[model samples]
Structures are given as C-alpha cells and as structure tokens.
Target chain A: MNESLFPAPAVALAQADVPVWEAVRFTAEGLVPAIAQQHDTGEVLMMAWMTRETLAETLTTGQACYWSRSRGKPWRKGETSGQRQRVLDVRLDCDGDTLLLLVDQDGAACHTGRRTCFYRAADASGTLATLTEPLVDPEVLYGPGGGHP
Target chain B: MNESLFPAPAVALAQADVPVWEAVRFTAEGLVPAIAQQHDTGEVLMMAWMTRETLAETLTTGQACYWSRSRGKPWRKGETSGQRQRVLDVRLDCDGDTLLLLVDQDGAACHTGRRTCFYRAADASGTLATLTEPLVDPEVLYGPGGGHP
Candidate 1:
C-alpha cells in the first residue's frame, strides 16, 4: 500500500496498481462528485455523486448510474420517470478529482418536469429568480414530483 | 502596494492592497475559466475563459461575458446573435479557483444555432454518438455553416 500525501484517509494503496473498475474513482469526502452535461448541446444537466460501484455501472452499461448521497444507495437517472441519461463520454480533468459526463438525456432531467433542476437563479443580492418556464408539467413527469408534498 | 503574483505585463497592479482580485485569479494563467449554465433548464451550455476585466464587466452589467483567447479580447455572450445569456448568479467553488455562472439563456447558446455546444458524445469504445439535433440552421448563425462546399 502506498502512503497518502495529504490530510485524509487512505482508501487503497492498490488504487493505482490494479484497476478493478473502468472509471478512475476518487472520493473527496466518501463521495465523488460528478458533473453531467448534455452530450449534443453542451448543456449542463445536473451534478450528482457516485461511488466506485455506481461509476462502474455507468462505464459498463453506457447508462448513468449514480450513488445518491441523499438516498445512500444506487440511482439510475430517469429510471422511475423515464428520463434516463445515456452515457456518451466520461471524462476526468487533469487532477482526476472531478468527472465530466457527456450524456444523451432522454427527457427532462428535473423532477419538476423541467429539463434540469437548476430552474432558479440567485442574484448577487441573494434574490432567487425563476429562470425558465417549465417545459413539462410536474404532475406528468414524476408521480407528484417524487411524491413531495 | 502588494507584490503582484501573476506575470501580466499588460496589467497594471497599482491598487494591489485595497480589495483587489483574489490570489487564485493571478494563478489562473491570467485567464480564469467560467462555466455557463442555462438558468431555466439548468443545462450547462458551455465553458469559456474570462479575464479580470471581462469578469468585472459581467458582474456590473448582469450579462454573460468572456475573454476570447483566440481574439485576445472580451466577448459578450449573445451580443451579436441576440441570444444573450442574462446572468443570474455567479459562484466561486470552495477553493475559489473556478467559477459557475448561472444565466437566463435566450435562444441558442451555440454559434451553430444549436441550443448548446455539446452535440456529440464519445463512448468508452471511442465511438461517437449524436446527442442533440440542431434547432436553427447554422448558415444564419455562423454567417454560413462551413459555406457551400
């Protein structure tokens, strides 16, 4: 096992030696953040986190598989809503700390039935403004928008 | 005056002490990268670089601005196309090294007259796939899409 450099726990000294998964995984705080973008239009869809296992699923299946930090388990984008994001390219920056995923988004990426979750904007004064009108109704997208009240 | 960190012969660092640009600004090869996302859709439209002056303009004008490395000058997003991206929020990550600019993007964000710039995806097998189809014809968008061969 190789020694870690910075102030953090060493996950595996063999991480560099043997490649168990196709993706190069690194956990910043037990979770690796991923930035997902629309493959064709360069539109950033959303940002999520994934574990080594989830990353492997994306690489192997050509479909996005994320480990929901909130749910604490695996997640298939659009699995329930039919808005799955098909994997096109998985890229890592020079640092190998973050991931840039190119995907073919089947439908809206947001539970609100919009194309993405970031439908609001925050101004310098911290005022939140609605950015775009919904493309699809939330009632039609998610079973009551993920069953939220 | 505090000693300047970046080697910018073009920039004058006289007011170095009074709330000047961040130290990370100087370390960014004199050009900081900016991420643009569609405000309503939360789709990441594109990524471009910015100089300090342009960054200042964007904040002051409430518009999307970028530093064109090719032209070696400033560019206002959608200025010529009328597809301008109105700035909603500008954020610096925890490290303050990178920037995220959320904007209300009007019309298309790409010169090809497409809603976004990422139009293709490459898989693990190096196979490229088309993700999004163009909304507007490129001829009018680019003054011509590669022109009649």
Candidate 2:
C-alpha cells in the first residue's frame, strides 16, 4: 500500500505520540477490525474492516470508512446506502489491534436494515432468537441487487 | 484443531439452524475476532481473538474465553486478573466473520484497570485524550510483575 496517500503520520498521531496507523496491528491482508458504537446510547452499530487508506480517510473526513474485503476497495459509509456514521470520536484499543468508533449513526447500520448488526441473542437454553425487526426494507437500501454496492 | 472436544454440532446450533462454529470464518491462524460488551449497559468492554477451542469453551462454560496470540494458548477470563466476563448472549455477524459477546463483566476489562479497553478518544483536531480513568491499579490486578501470567 502507498503510505503517501495518507495524511502525514505526525498529523494523525494518537496517544503517547504514536502514529495511529503505526500502532495498528493489521492482518496479512492489511486490514484491521473497527467497531462502530452509538456515542450516546452505547449501542454497537456494526463491525467492519478498515485498511490504512480507509482509516486515513475516516480520520480526515470525520466519517466512517471501511475496507470491503470482497470488493477490495475503500467504502465510505452511506455512499451506496444512506446509513451514514458520523464519527464523534475515534479510539484504538490498548493493544492497538482493534479500533472503537463513537459515532452518530443515521438510519440502519446493518445491510438487513436493522438498527444494529447484532439483532440476535442466544438464550439460556442455547437457542438463538432475533431480538429486533428491520427498521427499513433492505431492498430500498440496496436496490434490486439486494446486496452491498 | 480438535473438533471432538466441542459439543455435538446439533446441540450447539445457533439461529437458522447453523452450527455455532460452522459458519465462522476463522483466519488462517484459526482465530476469529470477538467483542465483549456489557449485557446491561451495552458498553463494549474489550475485543480479543478466539480460537475454535476457546469459542467452544466459552459456549459450554458460559464464560468468556480468548486465545492469547502472543502466548499461543487459551486464556479464560478472570483466570489470573480477576476480571471475569460472564457470557449472557452471543451473536455472529451476517458475514459470519465476527462474534459479539454480551457479557456481565466483573471488575475492569482493561489491563490498564479501566472499565473498558477503549478509554482514549481522538478529537477533530487529531488530538488524543483519555475518556476514562483507571478503576483499579495495574499492580493490584497483575501483581508486581506487570505482565500477563
């Protein structure tokens, strides 16, 4: 990956003077796990992979950007669907392998049009149950393709 | 990995009749990302990697178990640090590449003694700041060695 496309490392330094991307432990595919949470509600919206380029774009734009492993490209949140995640804060885990995004989410975060990706819960009987209903029709969000863009 | 140690696939099925671990997309190292969130507060406590064995252990034991990539072993929560995370619910992402753990966390979830692992946030100016303070001293939790057991 070309590091030149990203902002200067010094400009995006995190805590302890460590460069944000420098501290991340990306996988062999150059992807890191990022979790988006509702800043006020503490509700976890979704989890996605972010490449160095997407991470940089997120930092610069104050918007959530993720790496689409299948598409092999950067995906700006709400680019195809109107479910944008406006970043309120960005955090890296103590180990720096994971990321936390406190965001002001608009509309559904899941492709299924659910408010959050985690709509299922396992009960004491070890049976999984859907905990929520889709807030919007998924077809409306993804169009006739019925898949991510 | 030994599949025999895990419960029968029929007995550990999740929603849609999918076996709990069958649909998981483990990395080349046989590891998957797991996020621990507070069951009541919905606050994300920590993120870790879990191997098939650890994931099975967590399901059967109803506790959080993770694989320590550095130590190359399964580490049960609160084994040495007294920071146990009791599993309340477990969910898989639509892509089946990530796991969400709703847990009743005991004590601090962070090695730094913070309630959550993500205690720092970066602002629009790209400046990092601490969002929370340590709930306990690191020395008290890890003993004087200041390293994982």
Candidate 3:
C-alpha cells in the first residue's frame, strides 16, 4: 500500500445505489473496454468493446454481449459458435471506463479455440514465445473461412 | 476444455522468434490494448492504450509507457505520481491485438488512489457496489488539481 504523506481524505466513493448501467462512464463513442475472465481459474480470456445497450442486455440475458467495433453491431458471445459466456459477475473500474466480467465459459473463450487469448509471452531476449496451444481447432470452431484474422 | 467434435488442425500458429513489437497487430490507429497486472497477486491493475513507440520504449526502458488518448501524448507510468510500474513480464494475446504486462506496481494504479482501477462490483440486484478503497489519497498522489475526472 502506498500510504499518503499528506493523508488527505479518500475521493473514490461507491455508487452502490445507482443502476449498474448508469454507473458506467462510456467513451464519447459510447463504448467501454470489457475484459472477460474465466470464473474459477481467474484466467483472462478475451477483451471486447461494449455499448450501453449490450451491457444492459448482458445483465438481463445473464450472458456476455459486446459491441463489435469492426462489425459495427451488437455481438452476443457464442451466437456464431457454441462458446457462450455465462456471466458470473460484472465489475466497473473506479474511473468507470473499463469493465471486468467473470464468466463460466461454455467453450474456449478465444475464437482461436484456445482457453485464453493471451498465449504469447516475451522472453528476456525480447523474442515472442507461444506459451499455450489451442485446445481446439479454429476451423472446427468457426468452420472454413470463418477464422479470425 | 471444449474439445472440437471435428478435431480439425489448429490455425493459430506461433509467431515466435520475431521481435516483440513486430508480432503485435496494432489497430488501424496504430494502437493496442495494454493490460497491466500485479505480478505476484495476478490482480489486473489497469488497462491502457499503447503505441508502437511506447511498447518499444517499455521493452527497452523496463518501464510501462502508454499513449494517453485524452492527453494526446506519451504517458510514462508514475511520471507525475511516482507510482511507476516495474514491468516483470510481457505477454501478447493470440490475435496480437492485446498485450498483458506483469508488473510490480509502486503505488495506487487508479488515479482515484485505489490499488486497482476495478473497484465496483455489480450485485445480483443490478446495483453497483464499491469493492476496494483507496490505498492513498489522490491529492498526495497527484497534488491538488491533479485529481482525475
């Protein structure tokens, strides 16, 4: 803990009474960064942009929904594949600019059929190393030509 | 693990033996999502955007440097607050769109003086709840008028 020398009063107050969606501070473009993590393992799976509508939908649906920046539409996780994320919890950052979603994933959280999207680690020599392999194949998950770039 | 029924070949291959910066797939804006986590605790402190220059600088300097979209300038962690991040490890996500940094945080990661930016957890009733308190005062971290919005 970084104890303050001045010992001023804490400024971060909880907005517990407010609605979850209302409490978020969305960007000017009406988007927020949302990170999904595996509920039990605590492994961060993937990150996506979410809109206020998708957020509310996620809460109501009890599943993960996000705004696809590239597709310019709402993205319901596992709609294309069977890798839906059953949201266990939703968290808002102090700044309200980011979100953390703890979820019980039905399948691989990554589109590439990996348990996690983070699989490459940089070594001391600055070389990238692949740490984990895909537990399933992308082709099997997305079908031919459905693989992500 | 959700094993594929078809069990096709893996499409995601290792981009090992390449320069760390080159392996990353930056957005059209030349930016990548960077997540900083506490090395020992595995606590995700914060998420920021990093340019290629900042990523290289971080690798070379062993310090976290991010591009401040709001300031439209380079943001070296702890430059003003003395809450520098001593990076211990760097990991790149499968799509190369996200970077995970394992770091030793010096002080509060949130400008609100909280240990982590993520402090609000949404309850079953859809109300937000503040989870963590500030470890230090924002005034002490950034001086008066330095408080974040």
Candidate 4:
C-alpha cells in the first residue's frame, strides 16, 4: 500500500455538516453498491458492496473497505495483494443509494491482476473479448484458485 | 446523438456465445444496478437500475435503457431529454450481478443537468461540496420541477 497517500484516519466530521452516513440508502440486505474509480484518470476499476460499518470505516480510514458477500466479512482493498485504494473523495448519487469512490489506486484493482475488473466487453456480435490484459500474475496476487468464488 | 456511433440494432448474437442477460442476478426487486461509463474516457456517468426487458432492449437497440423506479416504467436514456447514450460495449461482473455499460454519452447524464449524477463529495470533515457544475439548465432539459420527484 502507498502509505504516503493515506489520509488521516478517523478524522472528526465537521460540526456544522450533516453526517455522511445518514444520507445513504442501504438495500434490504444492508448493502450498497460502491464503484471505485481512478480519481485523476476517471478509469473505473472495480465495484463491490459496502455495509454501513465498512462504509464508515472507509470514510474514517480513507481507504477502500468492502463487505465481501462470499467471505461474509469486511475486505480491505489490497489487504492481501497490495492493491490498496486511497480514498480521495466519496460520493453518493442523487437518490442516495449507490456510492462512487474516487481513489488513488496503488496497483492492479482486479484479483486477476488486471488494472480493472471490467476488462471484458461484449460487441454487437455478442462475443466477449478481453479489453485489457492482466498487469500482474494472478498467482502473485491471490495464489491459486485465482480468487474465484 | 451520433447516429453512426450506434451499432446495428438487434445484431445477431454469436451462436457459440452464451447470452449475457441469462447470467445477471437481479435483486429481490427484480432490478440490477447498471453503471454507464464513457467508453473512451472511462468516466462513470451514472448508475441506474435495469430489468430483464430493459437490459434486452439496451442490447438490441444499442442504447442505454433503464427501469425508472419512480415512474415504474422503462426509461430510454435521453428519450425525453435528448441525452442518449450510444452503447459501445457492455459487460457483466464476474458474479454476473451488476452491469457496466460502456457508451458514448450525448449531453448531460444527470437529470439535474450535470454530466454525472454524482456531483457531491463528502470530505473527511464531513463537509459536502459540489464537485461539478451543471452542464445545462435543468429547465432546458426536463422543464419546471426538473424531473424531481
């Protein structure tokens, strides 16, 4: 993880401003879809779900924290593979349901070791093609099973 | 709208390929979040929901179509405002629950007349700030109440 880019953790909310967490509209499952995008380049990296606790942690720590549906726990981005995303800004849509995270990504965002999880695209012919190649070996990131569920 | 950029409507899906819509995991509400990103720039413009029919329509028509929860109907992006999104490609996450639409967006993507619906960012101090100004007047697009529900 890029330590220098990390924002001060657990900073106090401004006294005059409303709490950020209040505006979020979590699903029935207490989860919200969070999309991570490169803060400067605007390249969307990956999307995952966030529970209230994880979202609060992400806001306080200024790092990406997700609620892993399969693992059934909090999964810190790059906690295992070092592809940490330093939070630059957090946004909620007008309806207050979805989240948009502008982050400074340290490395490849995909467990497949690609810069982005969305590296495949479907053409008009309905054929799926790889839009981007893996930047690092999967073995180097998650070891075996390629992080598959 | 860029007519030439539109892929042929209802182009044949390759026989060998599995139809993408089958893999999607809609929520209990029968909705899946579909994110629209600028194909070339990688800028995420908006996040909306899609039903199976809307998803199919988007694929066959090569345009962005969504399920408007408020209106309870299929909403063809730019159908009313002339801010259509021409689909360049489509993608599903590994779990096939969420959708990513890579498209060429025409005009503002937000009903508020902003390029993106997510125009507010919350800082560590809990202050909310406008990140982008509206590209056009909402009155010019949606008129009157500006589509606010």
Best by TM-score: 2
Lowest lDDT block of 10, candidate 3 chain A: A1-10
By descending lDDT, how would the candidates be arranged?
Answer: 3, 4, 2, 1
Per-residue accuracy of model 1 over B1-149 as CA lDDT, tens digit each:
21221111232222223122453243335886667766555565666777878777887789888987667778887766677888766654323345567677887776666675544333454333344556777666556442110
Error at A29, model 1, angstroms? 28
Interface root mean square deviation per prediction: 15.4, 7.4, 7.2, 6.4
Error of 2 at B5 (Å): 34
- In candidate 4, what are the lDDT values of residues B1-149, reduced to their tens digit? 33322122343333325556666679888998889987766667889999988888888899988999998999999987888999877876656677888889998998899888876667775556555668899899887888642
Model 3 clash pairs are: none
Which pairs of residues collide in model 4?
A14-B125
Cα displacement (angstroms), candidate 1, residue B37, comes to: 0.8
DockQ of structure 4:
0.30
Candidate 2 chain B, which ten residues in sequence have the lowest lDDT sum?
B1-10
Relative to the true structure, candidate 4 reaches a TM of 0.83
lDDT of 4 by residue, A1-149 (tens): 32222122344232324556777789888998999988766667788999989988998899999999999999999888878999877887777788899898987988888887766566665555555667899788888777642
Candidate 4 or 1, higher lDDT: 4
Chain B alone: TM-score in each candidate? 0.78, 0.87, 0.86, 0.86
Predicted candidate 3 versus true structure: per-residue lDDT over A23-120, tens digit per residue: 88897899998988766555678888899889988888889999988788988898877888998778788767889887888878787788878777
Report the Cα lDDT for candidate 4: 0.77
Worst 10 residues of 4 chain A by lDDT: A1-10
Question: C-alpha displacement of B8 in model 1, angstroms?
Answer: 34
Least accurate stretch of 10 residues (summed lDDT) in model 3 chain B?
B1-10
Q: Each prediction's Cα lDDT score?
A: 0.59, 0.76, 0.78, 0.77
